[model samples]
Target chain A: MTDHAPKDIDTLIELLAKLPGLGPRSARRAVLHMIRKRSILLTPLADQMQRVAETARECLNCGNVGTADVCDICANEARGNGILCVVEDVADLWAMERAAVFKGRYHVLGGTLSALDAVGPEELRIPQLVDRVTSENVTEVILALNATIDGQTTAHYIADQLEGRVTLTSLAQGVPIGGELDYLDEGTITAALNARRQI
Target chain B: MTDHAPKDIDTLIELLAKLPGLGPRSARRAVLHMIRKRSILLTPLADQMQRVAETARECLNCGNVGTADVCDICANEARGNGILCVVEDVADLWAMERAAVFKGRYHVLGGTLSALDAVGPEELRIPQLVDRVTSENVTEVILALNATIDGQTTAHYIADQLEGRVTLTSLAQGVPIGGELDYLDEGTITAALNARRQI
Candidate 1:
């Protein structure tokens, strides 16, 4: 609530501060930079934000965000390889896509089941995922959940529910492609060693 | 250009990455957060950004960014205390305002004199600052430029230009208040000792 800038500008700063990884000080600096570069950066960003606000929506089938009811992957016939990749959130799905190795449709669970927070099977998209597996004729389900305790619990629950119905899999635990062994945590090092290849 | 998200969302991320302190990863996260909280955060932020984009402008008298030709500080008669504070940029002016100790109006020079970049006094608002000193009946001018080499050079040049007309003063150089001696650079320590005051 700085009196130095106009009210609208201060409001913009407040909103910007709410963004992840941006605090009040950085938000102020960002606002000042945008104000200075109004024509090139600020105006276009404002337009884009408005357009996204008006059009963006979650895909009804997969829980992925897009402007359409069905996300691009869910709508594309080419992506329906009878393999479904289940992720904890849209960010995880997007990360998998960035690797460009997985050539199949994805189901975003929105969140993992958290017993501590009273979150259960009904809280996430687990029911919808089960329905999709049977309806979409999915043959294999890949669980790409985070390697956290909650994520593991959720994965196990989903695997038990879908047992014998489809081939269930999870991402392998290993040393990252370019990771240095010295910098890796103890758990990762153990996993990499235990899963050591013949080569 | 990620093929995972829709075109508009990708565009939004790209534009957001151009903002200060935000990179591609943070921009993607921010876009996702905004889309997820469209009703509460995204829509209002877009509206505020658009408002500021349309209304915000630099004050003609002082180069301060506001929603009017003359900024609030420039328009305030009470702030016209016959002492003008000059800063190298709008951020510095805002910093001075944050301190809330300076009761006089500010003149933003836009940039300092950089010989390497061939930026001279004419490139800045030096001429306009001189005009304001005489037109506004100012008796003292405080040069609150940075302690950098270019900033010092600019301060000295301005002081020489307004030597006999009015009292010219530059911000004092010393160890910053509450600064640890071990963390301070040698130059600051030397300046603090040289300018030691009697109790």
Candidate 2:
């Protein structure tokens, strides 16, 4: 589908279509909406994007993205507890922060260990995590990885590396806070049953 | 939910959330993805947006947006077939262009006549359309407004103004091409039956 929209407008649509969850049709709609609301939406959005493009950077310490080199979390000395939460990516780190429960700092692994993709300990920030554990005197390491097979494999590997150096724990397997029993998978149900708690 | 992400990152997410089809959660996800793919996606997108913001403008003759005073469609003398398609907005004009069937120029009404909102003929491009019909030697005018009530009301108003000046037509309502009878709405089915052709 082709419209005689200006070359710049077409380029904008093409770039917008590359965003997650937006296809060509939605991208076109978004561009049209931006054009119609040029003073309010388009100009501001463009300015914000330009600012972000100039300033956004990954946190060297935890892989979290921010305008600064170390990110706000890594820079805040108050959040540096004796516990460190290990996560697969910055998104996971952000999710944990949203829960507002984990007060300690995080260590983003970049990605899990994937033998199929030739990803190993060195490919991730595993070495840096070990260095941090020793240097920061961390007493506990929480494995906050996903429940996927790759996630479990990576967790096991990290657990082996920090075996005697620090106490290791993982997020529990059970029904989610407001999840229904009938909707859960059998594996989750079995895991929850085996790890039942006393009332 | 709040994270210790940089203030700039948070502001970017907040602005992105204002876009259509995106909530705060999706905006956060999109920001994270853009940050991760900064070099390939984010930077290029920012550049394109800035370019469009600087150059994009509405055509003086028609209401279509382009980088020039007159839009490409309006400037193309070959497309000036004495047949003008009047649309409620630029998006409808774009949709017609995507179909690649229409060869005539377009006149964007900007919006329909809405008494509730106090919008009248002067508020839209009604006078400009009337002027164009005579000055451009337009012999036919297709009202390609939407099927909404406001759309039909506006179409009838335009038809009244240009009654004897040019032949007036509108998009036909029927079962869409490849549409199934079972999935069709009652109104559409009735319309299709009434407009049935001889086999």
The number of the candidate with the highest lDDT is 1
Which window of ten consecutive residues has the lowest lDDT sum in model 1 chain A?
A: A1-10
Model 2 interface CAPRI class = medium
- Candidate 2 local lDDT, B77-100, one digit each (tens): 999999999998887888889898
| Candidate 1, A84-169: lDDT as tens digits | 99998888888999999999999998888987888888878899989999999999999999999989999999999999999999
Cα lDDT of model 1 overall?
Answer: 0.91
Q: What interface RMSD, in Å and to 1 decimal, does model 2 have?
A: 1.6
Worst 10 residues of 2 chain A by lDDT: A1-10
Q: RMSD per prediction, one decimal?
A: 1.6, 2.1
| Deviation from native of the Cα of residue A120 in model 2, angstroms | 3.0
Error of 2 at A30 (Å): 1.4
In candidate 2 the C-alpha lDDT for residue B9 amounts to 79
